[model samples]
Target: MTTTDMLTGALAAAARGWHVFPLLPSTKRPARPNHRERDCTGTDPRCRAGHTGWDARATTDQTRIRRAWSSNNPSYGIGIACGPSGLVVVDLDTHKPGTEIPEPWNRFGIRTGEDVLDHLAGARGGTITPTYTVRTPSGGTHLYYTAPEGVRYGNTAGTIGWLVDTRAHGGYVVAPPTTIGSSSYVVTDDRPAAPLPLFLLDLLKPQRHTTSAAAPKRFDARTDRVPAYVASAIKGEVAKVTSAGAKQHNHRLLCAAIALGQLVAGGVLDERTAYDALTDAARVLMARGCDCTPIEVDRTIRSGFHIGSRNPRTPGTTRDNSRKAA
Candidate 1:
């Protein structure tokens, strides 16, 4: 298959549940610390003082990762993850043909799997280097060095940053700017690199951790009981309420609920309790007044549904009365 065709196939596979991130551009986010101090117990100095830190053993999620430019709070940023170890952080910003390797520990290159190995061999005085490759959602490949034992590779943000040290870590991600052709492969000289064995591939496939506290059940958005935007907001909000605290967690959801609730409060589901709950929530958020879009949020008092308990308005079904009331 052609490169675009291969990408489409990968995206189709991703849609079936493999998370995919289109290499799209995002606005520059107001810069935050490359790292945050956290208080896991909620009683530590950082936790009480509102500091943040990432736990090495903490589960890494594709949807909950965030980067410098994400709008979603504590956005689950995109990266190439392998068998419990995070490879390189993918830079979605630059799309040029050549690869951009990080400095001091300059390891990544434009070469393919086969060629990268040779380059590393020359650099390391002909020492044999082992390599592993992963197929990206865009049908590109991520090359890694199987570091010798006792070597360590990690960044300050734990699961977030793309920084890799050559002697310290056994593996590194192929930087984003690097592009591999349909027939070209990569080579590395760090160690002896080879194709992944089936046993390792089986382990590398993404699987939700059984130990993850079962995600709280969420109301179905596909049922068309809620307006599309409101349903989207609810799905987004549910993930918000339960999320472990991160940079972008609360403000957007708070704003979304306010906007949607105000829009749909006076219609068929109009009740003082639901209306008051939403209004109060909005007011609290507005008090803090972080920047967010003014979208309406409506919720059913009894059922956890956004619009109402039963079959409610679908995307195109906003009732005239509801609009008038809004």
Candidate 2:
């Protein structure tokens, strides 16, 4: 088999364990449904019913707020991808207003079963620790982390993720996809100071919801036509991973590859051959040591709409609850 074929085969093999789905080539049809055109409702109880874009989470205008996390995929033994808007919690054990801790904020206490890691670094007046922060397409921020094992993913309750009693509930087994510090998640290459040292005091002060940013004029999902800024950011990430020889799980690489594939299908690719490019990129990322279970890869690519740039997540958005799946 060709190198691409060999890599694809290997990725397929690894996916069987992790639950990753392959990025299938779309039929070249003139009227394919836009992945962005569907409502998240009905998929799960926590899905914001009737909401199409990011602003559906809003009740009023000035109420917009956003949350950040200490780190991504904080598992110790098993590695998890902590997918797009990983911080947002969708399930909250059916909590109500005034009871809801805001989805993302509650995940620490709920899913991972610990207080959120403060991202602030060096505030202790000692040596600083490296920090990375990245903005998601939903206008939310994802703080990746390296945490102990027992944290996991679940599809119980018809949601993609929910905190199930790992010992008793007997649902999906979730684990970190790689080692902490080595594979937590990528924030910005800017390496902002870890925010944990400063915010670690209250443990719940920082809010997880943010108002959606106004849609940019002339937005395009085409890989080539992607907003210059977004394109630059993606390129920068690619460069950072490549230059540092960063390794991730197959799930992460697959999510990224599928994202590129969808973008290509949407006419965003500079090159017309998005399927081949995606497969090739997956191979390259895998070659670089990015690792993930096939299950994780499959799960991520099938759920690529979450990677969209226009649909910003809101603080207290229904999806932010830990009761919801990741």
Candidate 3:
């Protein structure tokens, strides 16, 4: 399609109140450089060099949208910023040519986007509610939903499992009619974006400890060793969360929660202690450029703590030392 056609689609999305931005011509990547070193803070001469910090660059103003598209690369693709657009897109990635199934999906026996969708549907008591679906240029799928109010969700990869990623706050997705090479993103389902389902919401919510009074007391026998163990566990989970990449924000938070939860279950730490330690670990990852928020860390820990409390670990049993912790 011509640049005019692509711009028209972008304007349509903007008309619907979705924030739009121009992507690099015919590419899914943003038209900006996101590196902190190259990041532009405001409208300076350097800022005009490239579109940096696209989350801030996304706009709904028709004049800005037109200017972006009418630039030298008028054929630029359309990118819809998720949070500003009130969108939460579930991106089910397909296996790229010559690449094996990603580790997360293979571990879960998921082979395709449809498989993940089916699993979600089954978990929700069958019959997944249909929403506006987009067929991506690379044979993947984008399932769009209206994000929940008062809850800001950022992009996440592998949090929902392998081959599944989310585009939310601080993220963007290629809009329909965008093309890369011979492939193009097309609207498969013409339905409007639907509200996120409850099951998905539960999965997405941050975990946090609510009751300090009910927190488990530290065990006397292993009191000295408890601090060391807790430190070790937190460090280990932090490493995992960090190594997983920014897209795995939720996944990383969940991993930290489970790790700290294990420590709480082992009586090495109380719920309050575990919550603080987990939060610190999450912060460490965030400082290193992970997309984690304090709220997300709290919620993840709370959720994991419940599970750990229910299945307290037996005393004297040690976790696998073979596994490297940080």
C-alpha positional error of residue 69 in candidate 3 after TM-score superposition, expressed in Å: 1.7
Deviation in angstroms for 187 in model 3? 0.8
**Model 1, which residues run further than 4 Å from truth?**
1-50, 54-77, 80-117, 122-131, 135-141, 145-149, 154-326
RMSD of each: 23.7, 24.4, 16.9
Model 3 lDDT-worst window of ten: 208-217
Q: What is the lDDT, from 0 to 100, of the residue 65 in candidate 1?
A: 30
Ranking by lDDT: 3, 1, 2
Runs of candidate 2 exceeding 4 Å displacement: 1-227, 240-247, 250-279, 288-299, 307-326
* Order of the predicted models by TM-score, top scorer first: 3, 1, 2
Q: Is candidate 1 or candidate 2 better by TM-score?
A: 1
Top candidate (TM-score): 3
TM-score of each: 0.23, 0.20, 0.57
Cα lDDT computed for each candidate against the true fold: 0.31, 0.28, 0.67
- Taking all chains together, the TM-score of candidate 1 against the true structure is 0.23
Q: Count the backbone clashes (under 3 Å) in each candidate.
A: 49, 75, 8
